[model samples]
Target: MTTTVLQNIRPWGAESVDLSIEDGLVTGLAPHRPGSAVPGGTEVLDGGGLLALPGLINSHAHVDKSWWGKPWVSYGGEATTQGRIAHERTERSALGIPSTDSTELVMKEFLRHGTTATRTHVDVDLGVGLDGIASVRAAAERLGGALEVEIVAFPQDGVMRRPGVLELLDRAAQEGATSIGGLDPAGIDRDPVAQLDGLVQIAVDRGVELDIHLHDGNDLGIFQIELLIERTVQAELQGRVNVSHGFALGDVQGARQEELVAALGEAGISWTSVAPPGRGRLPWASMREHGVRLGLGTDGIRDLWSPYGDGDMLRIALGFARVHGLRHDAELAAAVQLTTTDSAPFVHRDQHELAPGSRADVVLLEAENVQDALLRTPRRELVLAGGRVVVEGGELTL
Candidate 1:
């Protein structure tokens, strides 16, 4: 029954308030009273009139495969998906891709950037088996709950193309992975139906969620997306299915795109994007109007695939706003929401915000408002995860 009081903070740049926490959950809030007295034996942290936000949530990430803290690894792989996959398989072993130490480093970087929760896709292929999952679990455990991680047992290598990968995915689901992941069914496997069928069957059988990567663009990507919608409804997975990087949704035009968006909404399928540059802009407005969920992620930072990213969800949110041509203050605020409150489902939270009954995961920054925070991407002055101060003054404490 430990209690902590965060004094003089503006939640989402609202009027100042004093937020109360007990036993790792937000308990109460009241208008800030300057020079207020506190009960004896209760811990107190002065927020210094900083703007507060719920700790950022990363909807998509690859924590298991990042080479974040090590010396710079030059990008030698081709810019294509298959090329990156092949290069990772060849180079990961030498770099100890799935080691607990490296995963911890990545998680620390995520924390330093104010992200407190993530849905990370750990590689689960014929080569790594479930070692990556184990490593990520160990790393999260070592952090003592400062960072909440939802594991997606990802088949970085194609599933059907490599024999026994589906079995491994099933085993991972059986072992309690929140979701099982698939990669480029049409583009990489070249057998979209078999791949989708296999992944959906596993999801249905194991009662775990399905999240598939769809990099094939235009008609090819649209074909696989339609297959996913049909399978999601057929399997009764509904909100349990997600599409990552569904580029085709943006490639199509006019009525055809509207039809697909409507189908996605009705099917209850959600989407996650890293918001990479040069790709077609997602039909985000239509998706929102259709009630489809969109979450932002950092993908894999400093991984074999790319030598970019610093685990900053704010930067990713800004990129998403820029890519979508968001200009209004409301739109900019919405971009920030995509990384926080709006992304609750991505990490399986019923509610994630600076409000009562939510987990006491708060990030404080020096900013005028939500829009200001999104634009400048200022340093997090303090971060509280589950009532514990994991970071203070832009540095990790644990």
Candidate 2:
């Protein structure tokens, strides 16, 4: 049990203060003053006026399928969602990039960029089984305790379309997966009721969370979410469910959009967006007002699906603001919220804010304030996970 004092830092770039860490927990925080007692020569880190923030949380990611540190392979064939899914499955086996290698490389990059916690969706199907989960889990363990990874056993292919997928999802849950995922129920499975019902049943029986990917836009997408809400109510899993990429909200207008967003809030369902280009996601204020939490993620990182992402959640926040036209300081501040507190729940942790008694996972950035940090995607000066400095001077220490 070691105690270190971080002196001369601005929390959220506010008043200068000293943060005390002990045994991987934030023990004390107080305004910096002269003649601070240091018994037995305590280690004190100089913040140098750096802005301290809660560690970034990636609410949604595909760690298993990332192609980072691999040869660039362009996605071939049709550009449709289903087409890309098929191509991804075919090329994944042919390319033979070991999941451990890819996941480790991506996790390292994420750590380098100041993300200390994440929720990664590992692909689970008949062909891959639980291999993806195992690989990512291994990478997380090897990274030591600095990074916390919450695994979702994702059925990328439709539950009904792929025989034995539901069984595999259950097996993944039994094998320690924290959550079960579903693909486009209406678009992929063509049976919204069956897909939603099956996922809910598994989630209820296994006592795990649910993360459903709904890419179907327009009326079809809205229909799928409605079915999901119905099932969620029936199972009484409102707060335990997340609807990722509910793009249909972008298609509807006025009263209809209001109606759907209100329903989502009423059910207490969470939403995550990768900030895809040309897609309409939930309005940040409306969702927050309705009590529906929102989080951000880098869906795929230079994967077979697309060539993108460098594992920087700050960079993702910049792009998200740009895509959504979040220009004002307040707006950008709101966008930053998506990457931190709002996303924390997906990782099975309470909302992480820079405060005394909070988890000691935090980042010190070379910026004046959070809005500036988001806009600049400033280099990380220091990163502490569990009160231990794992990254310093924009590099990983362990």
Candidate 3:
């Protein structure tokens, strides 16, 4: 087994430690002090005064709709709601999603974020009309070694409204789609609750996870969301279920919102949020307090649906910290969790910290402490995946 030595690793501000790699696993980590013995064939990384933590994981993303990858959904900005939506409609109509630019750029930029794993959504062919799901799966395959990737066969448009959508969702799951996704409870169909229930049933039968997308925050959405949670619980698919873009919860008012929060808390459903700096709706604190697995995601990257995300989970993590007002320790955890803990299954090993026998998927930051690392910077001193150096100082070598 090829062994490498990382001599001066200040793991999450541990002061000092020596990391040993054996066959792509962190075999051992001993405290670093004077006269420390270096294992044979081990190349120690000079990472003193810097924090090293687990590689970030992007829990939810549209692989084919990211900027570095694809189009903005055109949901304009805080400046003008109607204008943003209009712009997005125009751009998305002109170029559409599941485009080549969206897929490739999203993948490339995700890697640039020190994300070794990602669970991304692929457009159901119903939306793009050319087996877009297959295309995304292919893209995920192409991005395999570069990033730990999984594709969810997502019914971007209403599954029932689109032709052959259910079959495609089923086929994708049967063939290896990690999760099933959908959008808008109220807008998709008259019985939005029933519609999503059907989709979740399909996922349950196929033996995959659920990731539902929601847009409506009004009574229709709240009712459907509650029903969605109830249906999952009834079917015994609670913790395994995920809800993306629960923006309605963040935007709703009064006692109704509180009631929804309590119910969602009971359901054990996780959530993924895309809170930009000025968006009126942000749900991190409530979700976290509710014991929900709050995950951060790049909903879109300069694409047709939304034009944001720079592909750096570091930035995403920092944004999460600032927007959510996380404490130092909480921020540290968020720094890793935004890309790690929140995103599951992609995590072949459920670890957000570097420890013995962990996969050698780690990044060295040019920081003096974990607090500094949490502060967010583009400086990635070194990135090691599977015990191989793929990037150093933000430069990709292999």
The candidate that wins on TM-score is 1
The residue-by-residue lDDT of candidate 2 on 53-138, one tens digit each, is 88899888998898788777876856888898888877888766337988998998888888989998998988888888889989
Worst 10-residue lDDT window for candidate 1 reads 277-286
Tens-digit lDDT string for candidate 1 (1-398): 89999999999999999999999999999999998899998999999999999999999999998887787888897879888888999999889888899899999989988999999999998888999999999999999999999999999999999999999999999999999999889899999999999999999999999999899999999999999999999989999999998988889999999999999999999999999987837989899999999999999888898888999999999999999899999999999999999999999999999989999999999999999999999998999999999899999999
True-structure lDDT of candidate 2:
0.85
Ranking under lDDT, best-scoring first?
Answer: 1, 2, 3
Q: Tell me the deviation in Å of residue 181 in model 3.
A: 0.4
User: Where is the poorest 10-residue window by lDDT in model 2?
Assistant: 276-285
Order of quality (TM-score): 1, 2, 3
lDDT (C-alpha) at residue 222 in model 3 = 68
Instruction: Score each candidate by Cα lDDT.
Output: 0.94, 0.85, 0.68
Candidate 3 lDDT at 315 equals: 74
Report the lDDT of model 1 for residue 154: 95
lDDT for residue 155 in candidate 2, whole number 0-100: 90
Model 3's number of clashes is: 24
lDDT of 3 by residue, 1-398 (tens): 68888777778667778778888778788887756767566676666545787777787677775445322234554433334434543455456545564676567666655777777777765445435665565665665476667777776656666668778888888888778887775666456766777787887799888888776665666676787888878988877677776766766766777667767778888777665665425555666687777777766666655555677777777776776677767556655566764565444356645777677778888776666776756477777776777677687765
Residue-level lDDT for 328 in candidate 3:
68
